[model samples]
Target: MSTVLFWFRNDLRLHDQPALHAALTSGATHLLPVVCLPAPDERTPWCFARVGPHRRAFTAAALRGLQQQTTVLGNPLLICQAPPAAALPQLAQAVGATTVVCEDIAAPYEQAEIAALRAAGLQVRTVWHSSLLHPADMPWPASDLPGVFTSFRQKVERAGITPAAPLPAPAQLLPPLDVPAPVLQAVGAEQGAAAIQPPAPPQGSDARSSFPYGTPGCDGSEGAVLAHLAQYLARKLPHSYKDTRNGLTGLDYSSKLSPWLATGALSPRQIYADLKAFERNHGANDGTYWLWFELLWRDYFRLLHLQYGAGLYRARGLSELPLAQHNQRGFERWCQGETGEPLVDAAMRELAATGYLSNRLRQVVASYLIYDLRGDWRAGAAWFESQLVDYDVYSNQANWLYIAGRGTDPRGGRRFNPTKQAQDHDADGSYRRLWGTA
Candidate 1:
């Protein structure tokens, strides 16, 4: 029987997963589902763990949920410690599989992994399922994508481009291959093997949290996210999303779908579909429109990556202007939430305690780090990668570069005044009181 290895990358959910769907329908009699855990000692140029404990904990929770779902479908997910370049080829050879299928990530490191797999003489098939709108469905080619977001949005709207409806999870997946259990165990036992365990539930929801991912129905799982989405819509929340989205604290202030969206537990198209449904039932309004608008922004960032390639990762960014100096001491203090700026410190502390921050706070903190602290923006981006449970490579880097004036921003860069932001967003001082100290 022919077998195909289905490797899971950032697209973790089985639902709305085109890559997994392709693998399942590939005419292979058996299927192998694998999730690669990065080597534990992996470090970024900024000298921090590539995947920190907070992100690891959330990912572990997500994987446990994925493993349960896949196991029920008869194909258990294999947790491999080796990087894809090394482990995927070995697994393909071990299973006598000729083809490996996975989601195509447009980032440099991910593209490099695909290159390595091909170099090893294995056939690799990749499906692009990361964005809300499929690349082929875009109004213009990636190379011709608008440099300004407004222009992109206008052109897409003018062309009446809508995202494809999300695919449903397959009811029956291919049966597992007869690979030896000892061999699987040995593969997992290799150095950097993922130690996945269900994370401890959050002690309790802080009344002040904008994103309470630790709450019972809000945990990082496909089921949990879908349920949360339903509940949010059921409460008529979309009608108010535009008004409340900028709120500094409180669960109802924003959709809070980003964590699951980033981890692939939820799909952007899935969210878009549900938003349209809500509008049909409740009437279209700014709140509903803004949700769709935000989804477009997400797609825009992914498109930017497609257009710019490794340029997005460079120190000088697309602007090619020299970046600010790196101050190790200042950067360290900023990370620790000890910058002596109450609002910035509070936001940092909240992020440290919970792997979340409101979209408003993210900008505020990024502006503070880049403009006020005069720190290297890449270091800030790296720290966020290590910290945020909802971190997306394209959005994180693009946003940082925009704030640093090195990205697609027509205006030089954004520099938020910390004191004014505090006054405008936290006039009551509730947010600061909740997280100002440590």
Candidate 2:
């Protein structure tokens, strides 16, 4: 029987897995499921060090969960640590795969990998699995997506483009194929480990961490995502998300879904489905169901990046607006979390110490770095790239552009006044004192 290989990237769960479903449908008796973890390279500047330790640990935990699920499905998820572009082709040949199926990733690097595999004369099928709604169901083409979020939301809402129902997992395990382990380590060996400090607290600890989630890092699994959704919905958290989302402290302040969305461990559609179900179970009110509004904001940024591509990375991003030059010392101070303002510094410190920061603080600190500090937003973005576990490229890049007066925000250059924000959000000085303010 012919074999089809399912390449697991961010979409980690078997339930509602479109790519895995496609692979299994190929009339192949033997299924090969593989995960490629890239070895950390310091020179890359975008490797594990930039990704921070907290997320790494969280991801490892998620990966363990995925392994368990895959085992129950009767196929061992082959974990390999190597650049997928370099390793996947060889693995495909070794396994004698007739076709390759994977979740479509919009990022440039991920797109390049799929193209490279197709160039090697293999049948590669990609599925849309990340969006809150599938691209096909949208009233507009992906290319025609509105540059402004409100316009996009209005058009979609007016058209009533409800998201497709999620696909269900196979009832029984797909028969496992006898294949050798791909030449990659699931965890780094001592020789390959980076020189780094100990990992920090997981997101859901309620330990007063700036950014809190149920777990840490990208573990390549879906169970953690399910747990977080269940808890947040049971208590009807979405109804209050818009109000508390801007809060600087406390566990209930934000949705904390970014990390899962960032790693593809949870799809936006899945989150939306759960949110709607919760609304049905309870009742639909602004306070109870507005979380999806926030998610649409996330989707807006994603579509913005997809529309403009590398233009969003330039100094003068989407708007082509001129930006001031970089300030090295200012950039350095901001990265070190020594910006002097108590709230700003505390937020940055929390990110450096825990690889997470609250949404309000993220905007405040980002605005300060770009406007007050006279630093390049890209530098701030790179720093964020190194530190944030939930850092999605689309959100991070587009947000930087918006702050720098170069993206979708019609009111350009909306710089956050850190002192004013600090006073309003942390009036009692509790958050400042907790982070050891001056």
Candidate 3:
């Protein structure tokens, strides 16, 4: 029987999984689905463990949830502790497969992984489905995308562009390709995910943290995702999201959807579909409209990656700006929330504690690192990648560049005055007090 190995990257869920669907329809008789966990001890150049505890807990939950679904479908997910370049070739050989199908990530490191697999003599088919709208459906070619987010959003709106409907989870995945235990052992594969140990099943033990992921509705599982979205819409929360989105310390203020989106546990299309249904049922308003606007911004960052591939990851992004000198001491202090800036410190503390942060605070802290502390934006980006449970590479890189005046930002760069920001967003000081940064 012919086999096709389906590699799970960031896109982890079954619902709205076009890539997985591609593998199912590829006519292979046996399918081996696998996800190579980042090497358990991988370190970023910043001399830190790349995946922090909270992101690990959330991602582990996602893997387990994915494993449970595939198991019920009669195909099991194989979790590997080695890198894809090392494990995939072995798995392919074990199953007698020469083909791999997975999600397309625009980032440099991810693209390199695909290259390595191809180098190893595997025919890799990458399907791009991470964004709300596909590149092909855009009003203008993504390659010639308007250099500005506002213009891009305007053009998309002028064309009335909307994401196509999301796909349902396949009722039955192709039967699992049976790999002998010796082969699995050689590659350090954990069948049915029995070997993976998430720090805590759902979350860390911090109660004061905004995202309380350990709480019943907040874990990274698909079951929790569906329930979270259902309850979010059932409460009619989207209608008031824009107004309350800036709140510093509560889950109710934001959609709290990024973690799921980042982990690929939830689909952006699923969110857009539900938001539209909400508007049709209750009529449209600015609050409901803003959520869609935010989704469009998410798409804008993805398209930018297509427009400029490795350039976005460079020290100075798309612009000719000189690299900002990284302040080693200042960055270390900032990461520890010891920068002595009350609002910024509080936000950093919150991020370290919960693996989540508000969008406003993210921009503020990024600006503080870039403009105030004179720190390298890349270092800040790496710190976020290491800490954020909701870290999406596209948005994170684009944002750091935007603040550092290195990307296509028309204003050159964005700098939020943290003092004024504190007065504006946290005048009551309750948020700072909550994080012990007051």
Candidate 4:
């Protein structure tokens, strides 16, 4: 009986999971699935005061969901709290596994870990999953990638980009591999470890959380995705998506799929397909189409990171715009949600309280931090790193740079007037009352 190890990185679900399906279908009788929780580097912005409790709570919730799914499917997910470079190889050796399978991650940390594993003489296989549309499926050669999204979209449309249908969950999970768990006290969490629960749903959840914890299997499965989309679309809410997308308060205004997408509970392709179906069922309009637009934006950010890996991580900034003047006091105020602008302060407070902010507020706050407060965009990005349940390295970093005039936005820089924005988005002062006055 051959043993194969399946390492779960960001892709946590069983459905539409190409790598997991491959691992189970590889004719290996003994299969091991592992989840690793890496320790935070105290020096990194994400480690400092940046990573807030809200996103952490959300991650813990999703992990619990994954564990339950894995258990029922046969191989219980063994949790480790060590860096991937250390934990994965150890697991492979313990199980006498011939090969380790996982989804390919283009992020720097993921790339480095994979390199380390290969260097250690382990046969590692990686599959690209998560994107609604795979890069390989995109028409243009990655090297010839368009400088802007419009070109990429046009090229893909011209070439007729078609998404591969999501793979089904393995009907029979391979028998569990017998392996000793590694000692991972330094990294904090151990196998079957529980996360620290938050006081509330989370900042974003509170902003839009009519749906609370439903059942045990509600977090990381396609079933959950179907449930959410069905209820949301059934209400015909997507028809108002464009109008309410920028709203700061209430559930119906936002799609609230970030947490699921971030943890692989839902795939981008799943969302795309659902939107197409909704359009057909409920009349295609700007609202129905906006959902696809948002997914494209998500894909655009992912591609940006793939297209410019290390550059996105540099302190000099991604777009490398004119280094804005730094104001430490202003930066602090912004993070603390005390910017004196009710809208900015409310958004920051909401983030502090729940670890989520509206997309509209995210742009507003980023603009104020960079242009009005004259703070470095890197600092704003770092702040977001600390917060945001849906914080993907590519999306958050690239977005901050875009607002600060450092990234791909041809508009150069966006300077938002906090007052005007508050008046425009929260005219009734309802959002203001919820988070408190600046």
Clashes of each: 0, 15, 0, 6
> What's the TM-score of each model vs. the native?
0.96, 0.89, 0.98, 0.90
Report the C-alpha displacement of residue 155, candidate 2, in angstroms. Answer: 1.6
Give the per-residue lDDT of model 1 (tens digit) for 109-179. Answer: 88999999999998999999989998899868899988888998888889999988999999978987766
Model 4, residue 252: displacement in angstroms? Answer: 0.8
What is the lDDT for 419 in model 2? 76
Q: Which candidate is the best by TM-score?
A: 3
lDDT of 3 at 199: 47
Could you tell which candidate, 3 or 4, scores higher by lDDT?
A: 3
1-438, model 4: which lDDT tens digit per residue? 689988888787777888988887888888888777655433454236544565556666766667777788777777776766777777777667769999887777678889998988899999888687888777665666677778777776678776777676677688886564334343334533744333343323343332232333234344566687778888998889998898777657888787678777787777777777888877888887788777877787888777888777666655554556778889889888887888888888877766677888889999988778888787788778777777777688788877877777688767788889988988888888877783
lDDT of 4 at 365: 91
The Cα local distance difference test for each model comes to 0.85, 0.72, 0.89, 0.73
- Which runs of model 4 end up more than 4 angstroms from their true locations? 40-43, 46-50, 181-192, 196-223, 318-320
**RMSD per prediction, one decimal?**
1.9, 3.5, 1.4, 3.0
lDDT of 2 at 289: 50
lDDT of 1: 0.85
lDDT score at residue 281, model 1, on the 0-100 scale: 90
User: Which residue runs of candidate 1 sit more than 4 Å off their true CA positions?
Assistant: 189-194, 200-208
